[model samples]
Target: MFQHSRLTEFLLGLFAATSILAPSAAHALGGDGDKVVARVVTFGGACEKCDLSGRRMSGAQILGANFSGAALVGSDMRSVRVLGANFSGADLSRADLTDSEMIGSNFSNANLSNARLRGVQARGVAFSSAIMVKADLRDTEAQGANFSRADLSSAQFNDTSLQGAVLSRVDGRGASFRDAALQGANLSSGRFDRAIFVDASMDGAVLNGGQFDGADFRDASLHRAALFGADLSGARNLDQDQINHACSDASTRLPKGLVPRTCRGVTPHWSPKAPPAPPAPPAPPRP
Candidate 1:
């Protein structure tokens, strides 16, 4: 009941906190130091030298706040409101931000390696070049967010919603997204080596020039998805009962229960491939 009660308090307390801080919070927007820095000290937490590592901050309104160069590694900021907050260069490794709201938050160059951001709402947030290796982002709502060139290796995001998000050139080795929704998302040239996408949706998603070596795609949906050029060496879990052969081809690694065929080769990241050859003639009566 402690976790449930904490979640309830998170909603109520954060709502009240935002109501109280909404007017004054606007003054600290866009690189204002003094106005946003006071709250870090007012809470009287263990932020000595700006180190909130492993602390628990479940319910809080931190709009337009600047946490540049701060260290919040392993902290718990679940269900909090963090709109327009700046977290540049912050160490958010292993932090828990579940069910939190982070509209227009900036996490440029932040170190969020192994962080837990499950079930969170993160609209218009920027994680450009951020390090999120092995993070857990299951069931999260991250529409219109930008994760360009981010390192998302070994991340887990099952059933997550990432509509219209940009993950261009991301390093997503060993990432898992079973049953996740990625409609209209652009993941072009991203390195998804050994990734898993069981029963996931990829409608209108661009997976051009990406790697899928040893990847798993059991029962996944790729309706109208673009796979211009990508590698599919040693892929698993692809069956004809799950996906049709007409869905994705040679450049794509087919899962189990399917046969290997000549697919379009579009190498991702490292080098581009040449165009396909002309059609070949059929054999004459098997002579």
Candidate 2:
């Protein structure tokens, strides 16, 4: 009888200990199976190759974080501030970063397919060679950002600011830049076939050797834009007045009855005007 009583006491003690330790363990090592569901608010320092797939990290501040090659697929990262972070080679497919601020971040070679980047402020971000197919970048301000050699097929850039951004050698087929600002942006050697540039400002933009076959340029401002050796034979809504505003060469293919002017020693009709500044980003989250 005494032995039975002792066993019951031991079992109760064990249960009490487990109850106390379980919460701490779960808090310290938060995960369900192979996936980790972190409840961290501010993310800093390095977490290279971390798997943060499907996590809800909205309004999180990622300051100077190195999340290179991390898996952030389908993550909810809306209103997140990613300052000076290294996200190179990261898988961010289908991630929602709407209204986020990503200043001076490097996303080179990252997979951003179908990502929602609406109203994002991405100044000076490097997205070279990134796969951004069908990404929604509407109303984004990506000035001076490098998107060189990136695949932006069918992506949306409506009302976006890409002023002075480098997009050389990009495959932007069927992409829409309606009412977007592309002043002084480098689109040289890029394939933008079937893309829409309706009402977009392309002043001083470099489109040399680019392919714009079947692309729409209706009412797009091309003042001082360079189109040397560009293929726009099948372009739609390209008026002679627009052609006169742009600097083109004999090698520039145009629609029927449209002639291109030589670029040598010809002065621009109007001075370059800068686009309106983007809205101020939200303040960073407190520590």
* Root-mean-square deviation of every model: 17.8, 11.5
lDDT of 2 by residue, 7-75 (tens): 234333433443355555646765331112222344455566767777666766777767788889998
Q: Write the per-residue lDDT of candidate 1 for residues 132-241, one digit (tens) a residue.
A: 99989889887767889999899987898877788889998899988888776778899888899888777667777777777787777665566656565455765554
- Distance from true location, Cα of 200 in model 1, Å: 0.4
Mind sharing the TM-score for model 1?
0.69
* lDDT leader: 2
Q: Output the lDDT of residue 37, model 2.
A: 28
Q: What is the lDDT of residue 263 in candidate 2?
A: 62
- Screening candidate 1 with a backbone cut-off below 3 angstroms (N, C-alpha, C), the clashing residue pairs are 209-268, 229-266, 238-255, 238-256, 250-263
What stretches of model 2 exceed 4 Å from their correct place?
1-40, 264-287
